[model samples]
Target: MKLFFAFAIIAIALSVVYGAPADPWNEYKTKHGKKFGSTAEDAQRKKLFLAKDALIAKHNSQPKASYQLEHNEFSDMTPAELSQYLGAVKPANKTRSLESMVRLEMETRQLPDSLDYRTDSCLPGVRNQKQCGSCWAFAAITPLEFARCKKHGALRAISEQQLVDCEPYDYGCGGGWYTNAWYYLQYEAGGAAKRSLYPYTATDNTCAFSSSMIGAKISSYGDLPSFDAAYMQSVLQDYGPISVAIAVTDSFFSYASGVYTDVECDDPNAYVNHAVVVVGWGTDNGIDYWIVRNSWGTKWGSAGYILMERGVNKCKIEKYPATILSVV
Candidate 1:
């Protein structure tokens, strides 16, 4: 019994000195279906996983934290590796000046205290963008899908790969702006192809666009003014979903739940690096937030969604709101 107790004490001391046991790492790997090419690779991944897990625990322990983090598919990835997921890039020159774009008139009536398009069945299931930086394509396609549902009474999965391949103004998976994608659909491609016909490859491929597979076409697209959450809500209610950009930080990669409000991402002029869809808005415990949809798959966030603090243009979310005006 004495010997057993001494061994146990040594084990505890070892854990305290080195870190926790490998049980959590093993379980995380299994949960995420993570596989490594070799033992060395596995060890490196485990180290990264442990470091991320510690950061998550530390952040969650803070009593005043507005959000939480957890081990998900990105848990084993390094910060540099995780950044590959962000693909939204700002255009060097606007296709049209922000002032020239049609803005939604502010609604005079009272907006709903809470709104969610997912409950309305207008939006489709969450999609995974994988390792490719094709978030701009995904973001651009979702609002079009929503508009189709609103206008035609049928929700259709349009091909994001079409934009990734055909849009000459934007750099396929390297990164892109949704407005440029819209311009391609409007003037160049004429229309978007159905997902069933032209599926997403998550890679830059030669344009294989066939006009015969056209599923949906937009008549016109417009941008909403920045720092106008009320107008954004009005547009969402009158129209459908709006494609917007946000400033993604290191903390954003591990976001699990709660209203995401980070000081680092609060700058109005902060570079918006990722594109997402704003499906709706609501107040949670007195804090207003936008129900933003992400393309990183259901394993991340609240089944591939994040509640961004609204009204304050949190993470530059309200900076560049663009949407299709009418579906054809």
Candidate 2:
């Protein structure tokens, strides 16, 4: 009896040291619906999971952390595996002239202090890109959907899969730019299909696009002023959601809540790796943040959204802002 009691005490102490339940590995797997092919694979994944859990705990424990980290669907993924979700590639011509692009005529009026297109019922439900590096497609499709809904008074889920399969310039799932996807919609595809017609397969498949399925068409698209947050804000207020690229760091995969501000994101030369939609902006406790929507589904972040630190151009968010002027 004494030996058994000692073992129990030891287990409790180990649990305390680990800062997790007695069988956190099992608990995590069960919670996330994880399955491993073999016991060895399971062990390897458990080690990775524990390490990530520890990092999350360490970051959240910080006294002045602007954001908090939490366990989610990505808790079991390695840094490399998490990176597979980032599909936004930088455009070859980083300094593409905006002269050919349509420009929004700014009105000399006070912009609202805060705005969220999600609440206006113009935006569609948050979607899961699901292991495919299709962030560009989601980012591009969302703003067009928003513009169409704003003008037509009906919300529709445009097909990201259409861009994934049909956009000749992009390498579907390998990585692509939202701008290229936008160009494809404007010219080649003639528009975009509805989600019902060409639902996301999350893979590089044969282009199954049909003209009858085209749900929305863009009249013109344009890039906002580089690093100009004020201009970006005005455009977002007038036009709707804007597609932009940002650097996705290690901490970004585990983001849970609060205004996300990472030191790595502040670097001017940081690689812009993921495309996301800027839905709105607001101030939280004197800290201004852009309300951004991600493509990782409702399970990630705050119901498939994140608040990024605004104005400082954190994560190069204002670098490649693009928006659809009108949808037919």
Candidate 3:
């Protein structure tokens, strides 16, 4: 009887030391099925849990306004671990080319107060860049897909794997630039093949992009004026989605939903680590915001989307908006 009582007490103490009876990562584990392989890994996971709990407590204690954070798979990862998973790096300047001479009629058109490309069937279904640092490829491909659909009346899934394998100038999964990917599609690949023809392996593989499978082509690609919200709106109103690279931080990864203001990672140009697509812009609770779509899958963010603070170049999104003229 005494041994039984002592065992119960020890179990309770262990529960207290480890965590509350309710495991916070239960949902994440169930969805991802990620488990620690060794004792060292287990210890790291515990440390991640503590770190995540601290972040959660800090977020919850603050008054609900601007944005909110949620504990997800990234919560268990350290900043360095997260960065390895984030593969989109700023492209080399020599490789960066944008044709500024061509006139886009959209730039001269009157823009709406708000525009969402998804509403106009310009945006395609959300994609998961699972375990691949190929966000640069995905972000670049999104605009082309939408632009092709806008012009040809048929939405086609362009292959990011084609860029991953075939783009001679850019690194495959390690990291690359949206602009570089765009240039590759325009010049090297001679327009990208459909995903069905060149499915994404999320890893570097041999280039098998066949011209016979090519379903879409890019006539030209250009960059929007830096920090110009009006020009951005006009372009989005006409061109559909645009590719953007943003400097993300510890807090940004923890983001679940809300109009993310510049309160956290205020330095948008600190490091253009992650590439995403800006489909539209609007206001939330009086806060101006840019509608950003991420490649972290539909399970993350607001159904694979986030509302970033607008007009201030939040995360350098306004600084480097790249898009292409597409046709099928």
Q: Which has the greatest lDDT?
A: 1
Runs of candidate 3 exceeding 4 Å displacement: 1-20, 25-28, 94-96, 99-110
TM-score of each: 0.91, 0.91, 0.88
Off by over 4 Å in 1: 1-22, 96-100, 267-269
What is the C-alpha lDDT profile of model 2 across 1-328, one tens digit per residue? 9999999999999988887646878887888899999998888888888899999999999998889999888888777888879999876774432333775677666878998877778888899998999999999999898899888999888899998899988789988988788777777778899999999999999999999999999888887778888888899888889999999887888899999988887676678899999999999878899999999999899999999999988888887898888777
| Residue 151 error, candidate 1, Å | 1.1
How many clashes in candidate 3? 0
Per-residue lDDT for 1-328 in model 3, tens only? 9999999999999988996677655655676676888879877887887788797778867896578877777777766678755677775663345532244555366656677766667578889887778889899889888888878887888898998898876678888888887777777777789899899888999988789989788888777777888888887776678888888877777677888874545653477788899999988788888899888888777888899999988877787787775554
**Candidate 2 regions off by >4 Å?**
1-21, 94-100
Model 1: per-residue lDDT, tens digit, 6-82?
99999999999998866998898888899999999999999998898898999999998888998888888887788
How big is the positional error of residue 40 in model 3, measured in Å on the Cα after superposition?
A: 3.1
Ranking by lDDT: 1, 2, 3
TM-score of 1: 0.91
lDDT of 2 at 1: 100
Clash list (residue pairs), candidate 1: none
Instruction: Go through the candidates in order and give the clash count of each.
Output: 0, 0, 0
